[model samples]
Target: MKLYVNNNLLLDNITIAESLKIRLVGLLNKKSLNENEGLLLKNCSLIHCFFMKFTIEAVYLSKDMKVLYKETVKPWRIGKLVKNCTHVLELPEGMTTGIGIGDNIILEGEKNGKGQ
Candidate 1:
C-alpha cells in the first residue's frame, strides 16, 4: 500500500500490523527501515523505542485517519501517549519532514486485477 498526506505521497509499500504478535514485535530487531517502507500499527496510542537500533518517525492518527500528533523518537526512548489516536504510522526518521498536524491520510493499495 501507499501512504499519502493530503494527496502528497509520503511512502510506499506500507505494512499493516494489527495482530497482537505483529504489533508487539514492531521494528524491534530491525536495524533500519527503507525510505519507502513504513509500518502502520492499528489500534495504538502509545509507542516506545526501547531496544530499537534506529530512530523513527511516529505519526499518530485518529479513528477517522486525521493526524493527531507526530514524533521523532530516538532509540531506547518512549513517546507520549496521544489522545484519540487509533492508528500509528511508523516510518524511518526524517521521512515526515513536511507532514503537519491535522493532515488527512490516504492509503491506496496495489492495482491487482483479480476480476473483482
Candidate 2:
C-alpha cells in the first residue's frame, strides 16, 4: 500500500498498521524509513517514539482523511495527542512540508479506508 496527497503528493509506499500488534510494534523494530516509505496507523490519535533510532514526521488525519494535525518527533519522545483523528501517517522526518491542515489525503487502492 501507499500514501498519497492531492492525488500524487508524496507517493510513498506504506504498511497499513491496523491490528493491535502491528500498531504496537510500529517503526520500533525498524532502524530507518526510506525516503519513499511510511506507516499508516488506523484508528490512532497519539504516538510515542520511545526506543526509536531516528526522527519521523507524524500526520494525524480524520476518518474522512483530512489532515487534523502534524508534528515532527525525535527519538525517545512522545508525540502530542491530536483530537478527532482516526488515522496517523508516519513518514521519514521532514517529509510533510507540502501537507497542511484540512488537506485531504488518500491511501492507494482504498475507499473510505476499506481495502479494495
Computed on alpha carbons, the lDDT of every model, listed in order, comes to 0.87, 0.85
lDDT of 1 by residue, 1-116 (tens): 89899999888778888778778888996899999998888888899999999999999999999998998999989987998999999999998887889999988996321222
Worst 10 residues of 2 by lDDT: 107-116
Model 2, residue pairs in steric clash = none
Model 2, span 20-98: residue lDDT tens: 8888889999999999888888988889999999999999999999999999999999988888988899999888998
TM-score of 2: 0.90
Candidate 1: residue pairs that collide: none
Error of 1 at 58 (Å): 0.7
Cα TM-score per model: 0.91, 0.90
Number of clashes recorded per candidate = 0, 0
Q: Pick the candidate with the highest TM-score.
A: 1
Model 1: residues >4 Å from true position, as ranges? Answer: 110-116
